[model samples]
Target chain A: MNKLPDALPVEKAAISDLARQTLHGTVDEATNARGRERMISAARAGASKSNGTQRRRRITRASVLLFAAAALAVSLVIWWPRAPLTFVTTGGEVTSTHDGGVRVATRDAESVTRFSDGSVVTFGVQSAGRLEGVRTNGARVVLTSGELHLDITHRKDTAWSIEAGPYVVRVTGTAFDVAWSPSEGAFVVAMRQGSVVVEGPLTPAGVSLRAGQHLVVARDGVMRMGEGTPPTLAELAVASSDAVALVSSAAPVVVSRAPSAPAEAPPSSSVPAIATSVAPSDRPASFAKLVAEGRYAQVVTAARGRGLEWVAESASLEELVALADAARYEKDGTLARAALEAERKRFATTQAGRNATFLLGRLAEDSDGNTARAIVLYDEYLQTGGPFSAEALGRKMLAVRKTRGDAGAEPIARAYLEKYPKGVYAAAARSIVGTP
Target chain B: MPLTVAARKVVPVVRWQTPAELVQALLAAEPEAHGVLWDRYSTSLRAVLRRSLGPDTEVEDALQEVFIRFFRALPTLREPAALGSFLFGIAVHVARGLLRKRRIRRWFRLTDDGEIPEPPDDVDPVSEQAQAAVRRLYVILDDLDDESRLVFVLRHIEGLEITELAACLKMSPATVKRRLARVTPLVFARARNDADLASFMAAPDQGERS
Candidate 1:
């Protein structure tokens, strides 16, 4: 036993004999024969292992290169550019073609379209259209038939244009409604913002419609301006849905640019001249004209029929409101309700929306004897700054008192009196609230 | 009672040949050359493997790997006459490679297929004690880095000179000396903590600071 320095006592040579014995298990002679056989076998195994490693390296390198190439190919497919036509599908089939023309057919269903430039177009039943010349800054389509509600997102750099039978309605951006009825030989464009300019082959002079305006033209190129100003919010109190929209004969929709009425409202915008394209035979008897001629039953009959719905869809706001009265007079509660509902749904934020809602309330109360419905509609109209807010509030309180009594209506009666001191229902409001 | 002499009397392999002729015969992969090299180097290679590794059954496999590598590389040898270093080079590489693998297995808390192999039953008491001390020293030395252990084993136990150890390990002489300096204190400290090896280490009390 000895103390080791800088190393252990387990010296290499000291353990040499033992290790060899332990590993070999024998120190016999004939060792030469044994060693030669083992060495030959081991050498063979080593050669195999080295070859296997080199083959594996080659395989791994090939696989990595293949994977990178595939990824790049997939990247190229996703980013390929300059699409001819972008397909949009709603509830119906979309046919995408190479000619930049996509026809949306809604035979029995509705088709909703999302334009590339951030606009949404919804086609009504039996409506179809072909969008052509699609561009980055605008959507251009030729609507064939039926109705389409459009909402163009606010892109000052873009515009939306739709060619219905005889007229093309063009707008920079706006929420609007359009309809084309060949049976009625009529085309109508209604919009609330982003001035629309209507002109077509039949219209040589294009008409620029400001917000709240509607331009109606017949295939005869006879254009009539329906004083059809839709209701702006401030005008709700005085503007009835039945208020007369100015009647003016507009230029026909034939020429490419049909000479336009001034782009701005000129003070004396000519004696509202009848643009020469107005052909009497090409226009159907309009709803307003039918009503003016006191054909109430005919108006209601047309409003309820499928053939005339396309015409009714293009009815001026005043004509639609008047149609409800005619339907009520004919005792067609369903027809009248449908007429008013259409106006309310289409112009829910406008003065016409308030007017239609208030009248529906009156019809429900008086004609249908549904006081509860009448009360609710009056409250809704009043809340929307109803043109007849003072009246609507008064009617609400009266309806409440008549049905539920003073216990539930004292506050509403007070609200009416407070808003309209000398209103038509002021006397009754005062009585309900116990004021002099 | 020397093992070599006793084994020689029992049996003999091919007669030894001149160094130059032996290298030529070895490169030619002659069975006789293989037998002679085996007879000459197996004992030293086993000792080197066992010291660098530990007393284990794997040492036999490592011994086989060294011989396999040596024969396979015989033709590549620029100076086959210098087979001593070439053979030792194979032994060093195989042994170190096994030690690294064992270190990794321990790091991942892996064990051999089953329980450890039991020592031989015929071992004498003194020889068993010596084997235990050697095993204990290695168990602790495993904690030292591989290069440090190489310097310690070659310099002290194997008795290789600094320059020779450098050449064997493929480092400069200065590097080997620097490694030796670093390993001395570390080997000392760990050896002190190992119950089986503490007795063989000098300055047991000062082991902690060494």
Candidate 2:
């Protein structure tokens, strides 16, 4: 068997996603109407071509045609069994238990498993999972405990699922990591690339984890998709064997660095994003330093291993902002959003929280592409009237234009220009308002 | 912009909620289905055009051609769920045809605008260098026979699986590979010499033969 080599430029590996954005921006109203017109003409031409055949078969019964179509469908389904996903390889201390579970334990070293579907799953030290069924459209595997990483090749329609106790992380094609421990009693999933839909018996509802997001769920039924990082091994194991006891009332604390460089911010301290759940004495500073150094992937991995349950309690709001900035540079929206959410929730009355709210509103509009949600968040954040007021107004108007009809959007466009005469979005506002 | 206030306030019109339902509507020759199709998949379909055809290729004309063909071929589509993939299949041929025509036009000394693009003022050296490398890559692609170049583009740029490529080109996977191999070295060896693109040849994928 032969395979094609990696022929694309490294940067162009994600060209398809970028191309989609390009198309969205480039396909104007004229192009859309033109394409639609062309399609209508082609369909009309097709119908005309088939008209003579229908006229010639005027005696044919509609009932006979319907019967033939149904019969063909039935025959095809009965004869064909969709191709099954088969295993390619596995590793770690594997044992087939009496309960019909293949227990895989990585005592010290990591174990790598590959599938014929071109998907790879790696288990970190002390981790374990059980082998499960691999069906045609997807596969089911149970993570008994500990950490595991997955790299899945993009598949059309088919989904691969990994079950960890009460939660299931389902993915079509993506790269991500998961950590679950019975003692810790939390199911954590981190997305590196692509997206996954996570739902479980204990979860309130299915929460989607886009690339750069993390989901944390405690055994006590407390779950949040964007509030904190993962818990550490020390928190899960050392302090107690009972995972439920480890559940902290306050969300996980994180100190994030701001953009433009952590050094620019005075005193170089990270802000307290979350309420101190685990209270790691020194980790927050080091974490902030990592973020400042633009080592976002490292920070995420560290949080997963140590359990994001801990952060320096003394971290300042400025430092938290920096940490979030670094996370954004790494394209980790979930982590960034989590930090911002914590800041908004914990320090609501402060200027820091106000800024966080504005940033969150922007993220909701730009990254999430939720125009309706953005409008609400922006409207609320604007009440704070902080440094980002001008920027926020421009973005809010853009969101408004998306939601409002062209005639209705005119007012918002006019309002935006009047507020900021030479604003960032002046040109855009002009186009929307049709101002000379 | 979203639907106007009046339209939203009006009795909520029943609409096709799923791809299957939309396909059914199109099959029935409902005119609204055309708008639905364009709104839903045009962005991705346009991307297919850019990847199959070059980025600079004037896709407005090609895009119109694709939509026309798409409507003509809708009745022949066996799987409604795979509408996106079906569009991709159509795009491969349309782009190939366009590429061939462009090559012929080039050969016949079609009037050239001679419009040269000026470099941006605030250029990132790394990005500029990469763009140049891509330009060189495509220039090499233009020199290859149409069949070989098409295979290379489909395999590399479009990221089509071998089986998918076979179905679209109406050729066996072996033949696709043979045609691809005819010009693979031209790109690989050239990239090997370019500092900016040399790493692409660092190590071939597992099962890939030189």
Cα RMSD (angstroms) for every candidate in the order listed: 21.4, 35.0
User: Candidates' DockQ values?
Assistant: 0.07, 0.07
Per-residue lDDT over A1-436 for candidate 2, one digit per residue giving the tens place of the 0 to 100 score: 2475434444333222322223221455676667657655656676775565566566365667878988989989876787776654456788774644356788888877777778887888899886566677666666768888899888776678787754677789999888887655657787789988775422212446787666665544344444334455445443321342334333433222223122232222353333334356655666655553445555554444443333233335544555455555555677667767766777778766776777777678767887888778777878776445666787888887777755766777788787555555778889888876
Tens digits of lDDT, candidate 1, B72-150 = 6766888755677777778888877876877787777765434566765766586675577667666666778887877
lDDT of 1 by residue, A280-332 (tens): 33223354454333345666655555334642366555556656655665667
lDDT of 1 at B179: 81
lDDT of 2 by residue, B1-210 (tens): 111111111123358766678789989878677666666666566666765555445576777677777776778889986777777778778888877777777777652233443444654575564455555565566677777777776666655777777778899987877776656666666656766555434543323221
Q: Which residue ranges in model 2 land beyond 4 Å of their true spot?
A: A5-436, B1-19, B111-130, B194-210
True contacts kept of 2: 0.16
In order of appearance, the predictions have TM-scores of: 0.42, 0.32
Let me know the TM-score candidate 1 reaches against the reference structure.
0.42
Q: Which stretches of candidate 1 lie over 4 Å from their true place?
A: A1-36, A44-436, B1-20, B192-195, B202-210
Give the fraction of reference interface contacts each candidate recovers: 0.11, 0.16
- Candidate 1 chain A: worst-modelled 10 consecutive residues by lDDT: A254-263
